[model samples]
Target: MEIWPAIDLRHGKPVRLRQGDYNQKTVFGDDPVEFAKRWQAAGAKRLHLVDLDAAKGDDPTANREAVARIVAETGLPCQMGGGVRDEAAIESLLGLGLNRLVVGSAALKQPDWFASMCDAYPKQLAAGIDARDGMVATDGWLETSSTPAIELAQDLRGRTENIAAIIYTDIARDGMMSGPNFEGLAQMAAATDIPLVASGGVTTYDDVRKLVQMQMPAAIVGRSIYDGVMQLEEVIEIAGDK
Candidate 1:
């Protein structure tokens, strides 16, 4: 299993929001690139980045630049999502050297377009399924949909060849540093044949261990590492990252 350290960028700064609430965010530092480098040095094999501003329908220019710098400096394979809804946005981010682009709202709202994108960019697109109580949330978790997350994952399973992974995030646990929703993740894993990248509420080595036990291909850890509730190196070691 791979452990990905997360960096949520808001206006070019590294920050994290609790329960996907923008009003409840904690800015970690001014330079997100430095944070990326820190994670890389700490033995992170890949990085998970989110553009908070973009996810909320704001301009992502600043965060885009920050992402570019991180890619140029750290040289770690990075996967980013937030406001990536169109071909142009996808091209722009891929041009920045991102290894994978995650699409959430777009995938839920327009499955055909998402499928076309997957066909166009094989192994470069990941479905970002952010959910609360098994229901899918869109537009950066500000709006919840009636669609069940497991159902969406099952639908996306048809395009598993093109889709790189499914990044399943439990919105309620995100940034809370409590623990990952193992039950929810397990349900998603069972519903889809595509690779599962667990996200949200990953706080301790035990959490990572359980995820590993669940056979998750990857797990994204955010607030816990930033808040020191968990150490990146320890979790990386637990994940057996080489």
Candidate 2:
């Protein structure tokens, strides 16, 4: 399994939000590019970059530039999401050389557009299914849709010629150091054939080990690494080769 260290950008700074709440945020750094380099220096093979400001709005140009610079400088394969709602933005981000582009609300609000993007981008697109209380959450985890996350994943399983991955994030456990939602992940994995990437509440090396034992493709760890709960080097050693 690949360990994806997260770098969420808000106003060009690295920060993390609790349960996807913008009000309950913690700034991790002033320079996201430097932070990405640190993660690379610590043995990060893949990086997870998010634009918090973009998730809530339509424009993410600043964070997009920051992400482009990080990818250019560190040479780490990065997957980015948030504020990706249109074809132009998607095309722009992909033009930046991102390994994968994660789409959330667009998948819910505009299935046709989502399918078109998947078809257009092939293995360069991933569906970000962020859930709360068994229901799929959209609009940065602020709105809970009627569709269940597992069902959504099942519906989108083979919609794309090469769907890069299905990134499942448990909003309740995110940024809380509580541990990942393994049961939910197992169910989602069982529901879809696409590669699954677990996100949220990954607080320790054992958490990563659990995901690897389950044969997950990858896991995203944010707060744990930023807060010193888990060392990046140790987590990478545990994950081994992708």
Candidate 3:
């Protein structure tokens, strides 16, 4: 499985939030571009970037400059999410050479707009199925929807052919240092034919190995790396080993 070290930006800095809470945050560094470089040097193949501020209804432009710098400076293929709602926002970010752009709430709330975007940018789109207790979470994970996460993925399969990946994030597990929701992951993987990217609660080498065994296309790790629980290189090696 491809291992993506995450760089979640909040207030123009790299920080990890507990259970997707902005108030309970741990700032890793002030310069996110430098952090990108550090991940690159440590053998990151691709980066998962997110704008926490933007995700929370803040100005979408807040982290654009930082994101552009990270992509340009490290020259790493990045998949970014958060606050990308319209065609204009999607166009602007794709112009930054982002490998993939993820749409979370928009997929469930504005299916038509999301479908149009998928049609416009084939193979460049992904749907983020961030959930809390199996219900879809929206608006930076602050609100939970009655829709089952698996049902949402199944619905999206019929909505657009443009989505190249399905990023399933277990909000409760996120930044909790517990472990990924393997059962939930397995269910989603079974529900969707799109390539899957697992996120949240990944804590150790075993987590990487388990994801590989589960046949995930890619996995995103954030808090563990920042907290010194595991190094990026070590996980890369674990994932890459034959």
Candidate 4:
């Protein structure tokens, strides 16, 4: 499994929100590029970046330039999500050296867009399936839908083959540091052929090990990494050993 340490950007800094709440944000670091550098130095293979401000409808281009700065500085794979709605936005970000773009709301709005995106940029896009109580959450996790995660994954097959991965976030556990919802992750992984990646509620190095040893393709650590419950070096070593 690939372990991706997350760097969620908010207000131009690395921050994490409780269960995707914008009002309850905790700043993880002052300089996100420096944070990315720290992880790269610790032997991180990839960085999962997100723009919470853009996810909240603030600005589509928020921190994209910062993304470019981090990519240039660390020279590591950076997969970003939030505020990417159209072909132009994807083009702009890819031009900025973003390794991958993660799409959530846009996928829900235009299911056909996935095929077009994958066709245009194969293996350069990722799908984020954020859910609350089994219902797919959208619009920055503020809205829930009748669509279940597996059903959506089933629907997304082939249309999203251009996707490099699937980031499945359990909104209830996100930023709470309880531990990832492993049961749900396993279930979803079993349900779809999509290469699954876990996200949210990662609270310890133990959590990272469990996910890695389980061989789920990837695990996205957010709040725990920011709050010091998890360390980048330890996770990289553990994942490597597994």
Candidate 5:
């Protein structure tokens, strides 16, 4: 399994929000590119980035610049999400050399556009499925839709050609330092054939071990590494990374 170190950007700084709540954010550092370099030095094969400000429909220019710096400095493949709602945004990020673009809120709010983008950017797009109690949450987790997360995964499976993976996140456990939603992940894995990248609540070596045991393709870790609850190198070793 691959362990992805998360670098969430808010106002060009590294920060993390509890349960996707913007008001409950904790700033980790002032320089996101340096943070990305630290993770890269620690054996990170890939990085997971989120633009909190953009996700909330605010200006994303700062975070976008931060992302460009991280990519240019680290020379490591990075996948980012947040306000990636249009073709121009996708073009801009891809032009910055992002390995993958994660589409969450826009995917749920506009299926046709999502489909078109998926078809347009094969193997370069990932569906960010953030869920609360198994239902899909959109608009930066500020709104919960009636769609079941598993069902959405299944639906995306039909367009597997365009999608690189399904980034399944349980909103309830996100940034809480809790363990991942194993059952929820299992259901999603069973529901779709696309590669599954487990997200949210992955905070310890044990959490990573369980994910490896489940044979997950990849997993995202954030708060634990930032808060000193877990070490990136240790978790990378636990995930069997060389």
Candidate 6:
């Protein structure tokens, strides 16, 4: 399993949102690139980035050139989502040497588009399935679609060519430091053959240990690492390798 240190950006600044609520925001830093470096220094091999502005469909975006520069300069394999809607966005990000692109709404709305993306960029596109109460959530957690997350993920599993991984985010516990939904994660892992990246909650090393023990492969941990509730070394140790 790979421990992906998260750097969620809002207006180009590192920010963490409570329960995916923009209003309940906590600004963690002014420089996201510096923050990425710190995570790398602390032994982060992979990074998870979210553009909060993009997630809300706001005009002001956080996934900027500066962030692409972080990838170019740091050379850490980074996966990012939020605001990446079209092939152009994916192209732009890929041009920056990004490791992978996490597409949520697009993948759910148009499976063919995802197929086309995979055909165009094999092993580069990742599907993000964020859920609340088991139902799939889209448009930055403001809208709950009729589809359940497990069902949505199972659909992703069938798409073999294009998808590199599936990032699963639980809405209720995100940024609350409660813990990740291990049961939900295990179910999704069972439902799909696609590599899964667990996200949200993730409050302690034991939480990571649980995921690792389950053999889920990868995960995205944010608040815990940022709030001193967990460490990169601890995550790395338990994550094992690959």
lDDT of each: 0.91, 0.89, 0.90, 0.83, 0.90, 0.85
lDDT score for residue 67 of model 5? 90
Writing each residue's lDDT as its tens digit, candidate 5 over 67-128 gives 98999999888999998999999998899889999999888877777878988898899999
lDDT for each residue of candidate 3 in 1-242, tens digit (9 for 90 to 100): 78888999987899889999988999887999988999899989799999887799998888989999998888988999998888888989999989999899999898778888888889899999899999999999989999999998888889888788988999989999999999999999998898999999999999999998888888999999988999999998988821
lDDT of 4 by residue, 176-230 (tens): 8889888999899888877888998878878888887678787887666666777
lDDT of 2 by residue, 1-242 (tens): 88899999998889999999999999976889988999999989889999988898846786877888999999989999998899998888889989898999998777777888888888888999999987999998889999999888777764555678888999999999999999999999988888999999999878988998999988998999989988899998898853
Give candidate 6's TM-score: 0.95
RMSD of 6: 1.4
- Full-model lDDT, candidate 3: 0.90
Looking at candidate 3, what is the lDDT of residue 113? 80
Error of 2 at 232 (Å): 0.6
What is the alpha-carbon lDDT of model 5 when measured against the actual structure? 0.90
Q: Quote the lDDT for 201 in model 5.
A: 98
Alpha-carbon error at 21 in model 2, in Å? 0.5
Candidate with the larger lDDT of 3 and 6: 3
Q: Write the per-residue lDDT of candidate 1 for residues 126-202, one digit (tens) a residue.
A: 99999989999999898999999998887876645698899999988998888989999888888878999999999
Q: What are the models' TM-scores?
A: 0.98, 0.97, 0.97, 0.95, 0.97, 0.95
Off by over 4 Å in 6: 60-62
In model 5, the Cα lDDT at residue 15 comes to 94
Worst 10 residues of 1 by lDDT: 152-161
Worst 10 residues of 5 by lDDT: 153-162
Q: Lowest summed-lDDT stretch of 10 residues in model 4?
A: 233-242
